[model samples]
Target: MFHLLDIKKHDDGISFDQTVDVKAQLLARDPDIIDVDSVHVVGNISFDSGLYLLNYDLTYRLVLPSSRSMEPVAFDNQLFISEVFIEEQDVASKKELVEDDLVLILEGDSVNLEDSVVDNILLNIPLRVLTEAELENEDLPSGESWSVLTEDQYQALQEEKKVENNPFSALNGLFED
Candidate 1:
């Protein structure tokens, strides 16, 4: 946590560059996270016109279960984020700033980088995680009585079924005379 007063006093900004290991904290929040590397955050926080601006680059590696195969998949994530923060009491007064940008309301007198990094990490988790092998494989999984079908394949199958079940096919030319 960085004190707002300390940062506010700096004319330029307070720069931070460090690697923090929040593996335990991350695992506690998400059981699906199989592994996590130390997070590297490099950024600056500056105060300007009653608003605190935070700009940072975050890099980390995460191992998670594959969406389809449930196998562990490693993801190397790099993100650049910029956010505006306002003191809780000054929210009403800084309404214009809030309206102009996505402002984070400070509950206390400090900024918590770990919390922000963790939140962003979770939010950025890919919905579909696939390994190299999975990406190369085109065959869909199948079982004894069930099989996965692509959207186009399913639509074609439905049309074929409708045509086979229709009873008016034999009388199609009867009305031509």
Candidate 2:
């Protein structure tokens, strides 16, 4: 947390470079995350034009279950974020300034960087994640009566089904006679 009063007093702004352990907090928010490394945040908060601007670069390693398989996979992430912080009373007047930017309305006298870090981490989670071996293997999973197929394979199968199930297919012999 960055105290607004302290930052506003300094012309150059307040800079922060630290490692934060948010594993318990993150796991509480999202049960899907298997584990996470300590988060590194390096940036400064500058007060300008009646607003506090936050700029930071965050790095962390997150472990999550694979999309195809349930095995845990580690993902390293580096992200840059710039956000505007507005006080509750100023939100209505400063809506235009924040419309085109990422902004957070401050509920107190300090800025919650941890919450921002957590939110961004959740947003950055990939839709699909595969293990190293899974990437190398070309085979899709299969069961006794059902099998996963590529898009092209599925399209071709659908075409074959259309031809096979055509009601007019049975009338072809009558027309030939």
Candidate 3:
């Protein structure tokens, strides 16, 4: 909660440290995230040069599914928020000049950082969650003819294919001349 008076009155600004349970909200957005253990937010909301600066550190613990095994993996992500909040009246002028992701407009009497924080959370979600336990198990889906390739394996394969594809490079001079 950003009280209009609190920020304008305190030069040093107000500090906030709280745990907000947004498990339901998280689940609604992404079903792959089984549970959101907790969301911790700590920051200072201060006024500077006609703009309200919100600098906060957001951390959340989530239970996600492993990429390969589909097992639950605990993931802790930390996101730093450096956002500027402007009054709604100022939005028309400011919005045209600014990028959408960086600044948030304060609609009414106060502003809420929840929406921005949630947006950042969405941006930070990893495409795949792999646990150490999963990595340690050398048995990663292999058959007699085919096997799961490690990241390095696929990279090496691409390099080999690149070289193989360019085998006729020495004959290029024939066409150039």
Candidate 4:
């Protein structure tokens, strides 16, 4: 839940501060998240010409489970803002409302600010994810599961496919016919 503020009419430029609640939502979505410490999000955002621009910095830490212990991972980066736009369009047949509607557009360097948040979260994710020892040992009921194939397993599968579909084998069949 990223805070959006000061979205009102002002004679001068509008100013607002916000704190994005990414960590809490992420953990809630994935209970396996053991720790999410020191997540920092800093950015400057502005709206102009029906668009929003955001430049930002992100830093965070993630903990992943291993066979013996949890592995700590860190991420730090800067991102540019690109585009932010309003999501409203007037219908041809509908009567115009008394109050004027304001739409915000986001693009270019400002768009990077939004992308930075998502990118940082993805970067923090473990390429090889595992559960803690306690969860691994527990006998849980059957449900949907997701896992990554190891390098060796993927290579072996590819090799097996190659042998089954060799071009030379097809040539031999053609000659026999």
TM-score top scorer = 1
| C-alpha lDDT of candidate 2 relative to the true structure | 0.89
The TM-score values for the models, in the order shown, are 0.87, 0.86, 0.75, 0.43
lDDT tens string, model 4, 31-57? 666566555666555544433344455
**Rank order (by TM-score, best first):** 1, 2, 3, 4
Given candidate 4, what's the lDDT at residue 67? Answer: 34
- Cα error, residue 165 of model 2, in Å, equals 3.4
Instruction: Point to the candidate with the largest lDDT.
Output: 1
| Cα lDDT tens digits for candidate 2, 42-134 | 999999978998999999999999877889999899999888889888888888866866577789999988988888888898888889988
**Which 10-residue span in candidate 3 carries the lowest summed lDDT?**
93-102
Ranking by lDDT: 1, 2, 3, 4
lDDT of each: 0.90, 0.89, 0.80, 0.47
Where does model 3 exceed 4 Å of error?
A: 92-101, 142-151, 158-177
**Stretches of candidate 4 exceeding 4 Å from the true structure:** 1-22, 67-83, 87-124, 129-177
Distance from true location, Cα of 176 in model 4, Å: 28
Residues 1-177, model 1: lDDT tens digits:
789999999989899999988898899999999999958999999999888888899999999999879999997999997878899888899787778767988888998888888888998999889888989997778999999887999999999999878898777889897
After the best TM-score superposition of candidate 3, give how far the Cα of residue 140 lies from its true spot, in angstroms: 4.0
Question: Number of clashes in model 1?
Answer: 0
Candidate 3 matches the true fold with a TM-score of: 0.75
Candidate 3 C-alpha lDDT tens digits along 1-177: 778777899999889998876677677887777887669999999997668898999998878889888888897888898888888777666765456555676777776767666767877888868778877875676779988987988899999888779979667779765
True lDDT of residue 126, candidate 4: 54
Question: Which has the better TM-score: candidate 1, or candidate 3?
Answer: 1
Error of 3 at 143 (Å): 6.7
